[model samples]
Target: MKRDFAVIGLGRFGGSICRELSMEGMEVLAIDIDEDKVNEFKNIASHAVIADSTDEATLKDLGIKNIDHVIVAIGDNIQASILTTVVLTDFNIKKITVKAQNDYHEKILNKIGADQVVHPERDMGKRIAHNIISNNILDYLELSDDHSIVEVKVGAKMLGKSLIDLDIRANYGCNVVAIKQGKDINVSPSAEDKLKEDDILIVIGADKDISRFEKHLVVDE
Candidate 1:
């Protein structure tokens, strides 16, 4: 099904999402207070409008309630972001993903019933840091302050060792949720499944535990 989306605040973050959604053939309504920003997405988005999203009347007039997901990516202006989110929640919007400026901002957005909150810069920094620290760590996705899901490339250190042999859950306190060997994926991989070089492990656990798993299991090239 083609889901409709409304992205308020046409800054770098919101603009990127608007473009991506449009490219994916999804209907998107791009809203921004600045005329110039709205104009940039005029041809790219299904609808681009210069309107203040925080204003309840403006949002209702644009039929934002019908959109399946709404992303609030208002940059810097915390008040506007919060106000827009409150308005959306009042309208009973299904999913609201907000880009928060800081920890405090994220907390408030959560309290206001935001479906998802993203700290882009902070998260990207952590991802890069993890990649720099290990050659086998392919990607790091933060689930919370404590937990994360990390995709790691199996290396020489773990070659031929089965899940039971390593006892990952007991040893590193992380779970191997899946294993990807080229085009094939073994979801919920069994204990008897052996590691092969270049295989990717989709691991989920506490951040500290994931770090431990990476340090000991993934070979540093």
Candidate 2:
């Protein structure tokens, strides 16, 4: 089934979401107060309109109630972001995700009933920082405040060690969810499978445990 999505605010973050959803063959209504921004997405989105999302009447006129998910990605305008979210909540949208500018914005969004709040810039910074800190860490994803999933390249310490020999779950408190070699991925890697150089391990665990696992196994001394 093709899900219906509405993305308000046509800034970089919102624009990116609109593009991705449309590319995935979902029905998307791209909304923005800017005429040029609306025009830019006219060919990409299922529908694009220059409408103020903070106005309840305008949203109702756009048939926003039919959208399965709404993303409020208003850039910098905290007032508009909060007001739009409040209006969406009043309409009982099934899922409302908001882009938070800061911690205070996130708190308000959560209190106002936003289902999910994302910090794109902050998250990208963290990913880049992780990539820079270690040559082995290829990517990082934050699952919660204290938990994360990371992609770590199989380093010298991990080379030739089988999953049983490492006993990662018992020793490091982490799980090897998958392993990637070249372009192929083993989603269910066996316990006897041995690690090879340049292979990537997708590990998930609490932040401290992941750090410990990385320092002891993935990172070179």
Candidate 3:
């Protein structure tokens, strides 16, 4: 079944989501107060309209209740973002993801029942910092305040070692959930599966444990 999505913003973040969803064959309704933004996505989304998302009547007339998911990615204007989210919650949308401009905005969105809140700039900054700290740390995803999932490139020290030999879960308190070698990925890598130099390990655990694991196994000696 094709999932129906409505994006209530046409800024960079929202526009990217609209384009990706449309490309993936999902039904997308792209909305923005800017006529130019709406026109730009007219050929990209299932429907594009210039409308104020904070206006309940406008949303109702657009049949927003029929959407399976709604993304409130209004940029800069925290008032509009919160108001749109409040309006969305009233319809009991299956899911509503909002882009938070700051910590205060996030708290308000959460209190008003936003299903998910994203801090894109903050998250990207963390990813970049991790990459700068260690070349082997390819990516970082925070699951919680103290937990994260990291993609680590296998270093020279780990090239010939197998999972059993390293005992990653026991020694580092981290799990190698998957191993990506070039375009192929091993989702269920065995204990005896050996690491290759170019392989990338998807590791998940507490932040401290992941840091230790990265220091010992990922970084070149």
Candidate 4:
């Protein structure tokens, strides 16, 4: 079956998601308390509606139950964000993603049943900062509280080393997700594949583990 998504709130965060999903060919329903915001997303998302998302009855009337996933992106309004997420859960929507304003908001969303809580602004800032801090790292993404995904250039130190010989997962607590060779990426790489000096690896693990793995890429005299 095809997947459908619903976006509640048309702020920058929500607006970007709605537009991206629409562009990716998913059927998306956009919602907001502001008519202008809804109109702004018109002709982009498959559907757009102006409604108060804090009202469970209103969400139900909008057929939120049929949505495969619902995104709660209400900006700065913790009450509305929580209420919307709870209501979506009550309706038994398959998946729910909420944007939290801060740690407290994220905790509340987590305890109240959001399948995923995103801190877009904070995460973007962290990524930018981390990229600036490291030479090998191209990017980083927090997969969970304990785990992250990182991309790093596989330099001379790691070149010609087989994954089994290096034992990355065992030694560094990280796993190579993919290898980027020039323009192509090899996903689900075999353990015996050798890392070339120029290869870029997409790895996943705990934040600390990634730091250790990045150290492994450094060349010694």
Candidate 5:
């Protein structure tokens, strides 16, 4: 099934999304106020349009109704971003994603009817901070507003214990979705599988539950 996507603003976020969607065999109509940016993505996107996304005429002319998803990626100009999002929603474009510069911007985007609001910079900062805070925590991915996926080392506390013995699901309210042992990975790790000191566990749970799980690894002084 092929889905059509329309992206407003040809900046990094929008441009990257258009490229990816096009690569995935989806038809993407890329839009930007700057002709130069539109030209840059001409080869990558299925189609590129140079127009002010805040203008209703441009959106109507682009055949926004055919688009299954519309992403508003205007940068720096919060007003332009919000205006573009509101216009797209008014046109009844399904699945709108807006880039927000700050908390205030996020709230505005939410109020303006954006299906999703992203804070790329703040999200990256949190991921980096999580990796730096613990040697055990290898990576972190937010699954939803309340849930996340985390990669962590098994460490000594969990060494020599089987999945059933640890009872991670009962204790942590999370599941070990995958196991990474050196270069080898086991998706859907079995309950009978023994955990080693260095095994990397891919866990999925609420953000608060993940925090509590990490704390259990540290020995109290």
Candidate 6:
């Protein structure tokens, strides 16, 4: 079943998420105080309306409480974002994800019961910096403050080595969660599996451990 989503504040971040969710065939209700922004997504979203999400009556009228998830994406206006998120929580919405402006804003959101808080600008910068620092890193995803999941291309050093032979977990404190070779992905890759030079290993571990693994085994070979 397609999930129902409500995206508040149709700025760049929220707009992008709304469009992607709609394209994926999910039911999305796009809301914003700006009529122009709401109208821009009229055909794209299941419903688009010009309404301030900070207003509890307006949210109730729109049946927002029944939505599976709500994204508070108010841009620049941190006050409005907090108000909207608080109202959503009061409504007992299943999930609430909020775009935080800074560390202080994120802290407040977390304290107020936001299910997820995203620092898009800061996180993207970290991801891009990591990618540039390591050419072998295909992708980087932050799981928490200290842990991350990275996709690293197998280098010459790792080529033809079985998982057991590498002893990745014991040696570097990282786990090879999956291996991708061309279009095939081995989610349950065995200890006996050997890595090809072209294989991509999806590794998960603490950020420091992943950095150590990448520097020693997946790069400069």
Number of backbone-clashing residue pairs for each candidate, in the order shown = 0, 0, 0, 0, 0, 0
For model 1, residues 101-181, the per-residue Cα lDDT tens digits are 999999999999999999988999999998998878889999878999999888787788988998989999999899998
Worst 10 residues of 4 by lDDT: 212-221
Per-residue CA lDDT of model 6 for 1-221, tens digit only, reads: 88999999899999999999999999999999999999999999999999988999999999998999999999999999999999999999999999999999999999999999999889888878877876778889999999999998887788899999999999999999999999999999988978887889999999999989988887765
Model 6 lDDT, full chain set = 0.93
lDDT assessment of candidate 4: 0.87
* Pairs that clash in candidate 1: none
Tens digit per residue, CA lDDT, model 3, 17-125: 9999999999999999999999999999999999999999999999999999999989999999999999999999999999999999999999999999999999999
The best candidate in terms of lDDT:
2
* TM-score versus the correct structure, for each prediction: 0.92, 0.95, 0.95, 0.85, 0.86, 0.94
The order of the candidates by TM-score, greatest first, is 2, 3, 6, 1, 5, 4
lDDT of 2: 0.95
How much is the lDDT of residue 121 in candidate 3?
93
Tell me the spans in candidate 5 whose CA falls farther than 4 Å from its real position: 180-188, 196-199, 218-221
**Alpha-carbon shift of residue 188 in model 6 (angstroms):** 2.7
Predicted structure 3: lDDT: 0.94
TM-score of 2: 0.95
Q: For residues 1-221, could you state the per-residue lDDT of candidate 2 as single tens digits?
A: 88999999999999999999999999999999999999999999999999989899999999999999999999999999999999999999999999999999999999999999999999999899888878999999999999999999988888999989999999999999999999999999988978999789999999999989987887788
- Evaluation by TM-score, superior candidate among 3 and 4: 3
Clashing pairs in 6: none
Off by over 4 Å in 4: 156-171, 187-197, 215-221
* Candidate closest to the true structure, highest TM-score: 2
Worst 10 residues of 6 by lDDT: 129-138
lDDT per residue for candidate 4 within 1-221, as digits (tens), equals: 66899999999999999999999899999999999999998889999999998888898898999999999999988998998888888998999999999999999999989999999998999788777766667888988887888888776677798888788889988888898989999897878988887788888888898877776654232
After superposition, which runs of candidate 6 have C-alpha atoms over 4 Å from their true positions? Answer: none
